[model samples]
Target: MIKPTPNPPELDDTTPYEFPGSKRFHEAAERALDHYLKPNALTLRFHKPSTMFQIAPDQDNESLLAHACESLASASIMTSDIAAYVDNPQRHTILAIQQIIMLAELAVNRVLDNVEMARSASHN
Candidate 1:
């Protein structure tokens, strides 16, 4: 019968390794974290209370609708601009969002037009 050979150990104990530029790499990583990850003190101090849910009680519906239309139109334009530079995979999604914004703008404008017509008819 032939004798079988023994298998080697998983880890080698002979090599002593040292990474070059490790100190410089650590310093660069620390600087990047300090620059981008740390929160800004100025931003923390300038927090304003959100006005999203606070509608003025005295504002008229026509003015409010007009404002909504303007905001939607602006959003549509902004989305279109963003879509211009987006990759092909996400470009379609951004364009669809833009279309939705435009549709909302059109609806608001139609409501405003109807309100104006009703007011004019009442005055005549």
Candidate 2:
């Protein structure tokens, strides 16, 4: 029996064009946070090892957990590196980038948490 893989969440390709005199940067960040926190293709990539470790009923989920930790760490490092380049703090583009960085941070945190939970559950 061949089951189809589920599709990941779609990433937006269009640029965000904020009108109304360049206000609402925080609102935009809030919306971005809400959207980015959801699991997507990006997150699923991190999840595959977790799923495989479970399905194979391997010796342990340690490898998968390590992978998850690595993914989060990589994201954090990349976000921090990018943050060094921003000059104007008030630009919408800057806000959007910040939102994206925040989302990345959130994703990493969730991945780590899920990995820990999986390891803990497996011990029972």
C-alpha RMSD in Å of predicted model 1 compared with the true structure: 9.9
For residue 19, model 1's alpha carbon misses the true position, in angstroms, by 41
TM-score of each: 0.58, 0.31
Clashing pairs in 2: none
Put down candidate 1 lDDT per residue, 1-124, tens digits, no spaces.
Answer: 6547445535657432246677678878889998898867987689787989998999999989989998998899999999999998799999999999998898998999899999999999
Q: Which segments of candidate 1 are over 4 A away from where they belong?
A: 1-53
Show the lowest summed lDDT stretch of 10 residues, model 1: 9-18
Off by over 4 Å in 2: 1-90
lDDT of 2 by residue, 3-121 (tens): 47546656767645456644577677878997878777777777745353354556455565556657655765665566567565635455566567567657766776787888799
Q: State the local distance difference test value for candidate 2.
A: 0.65
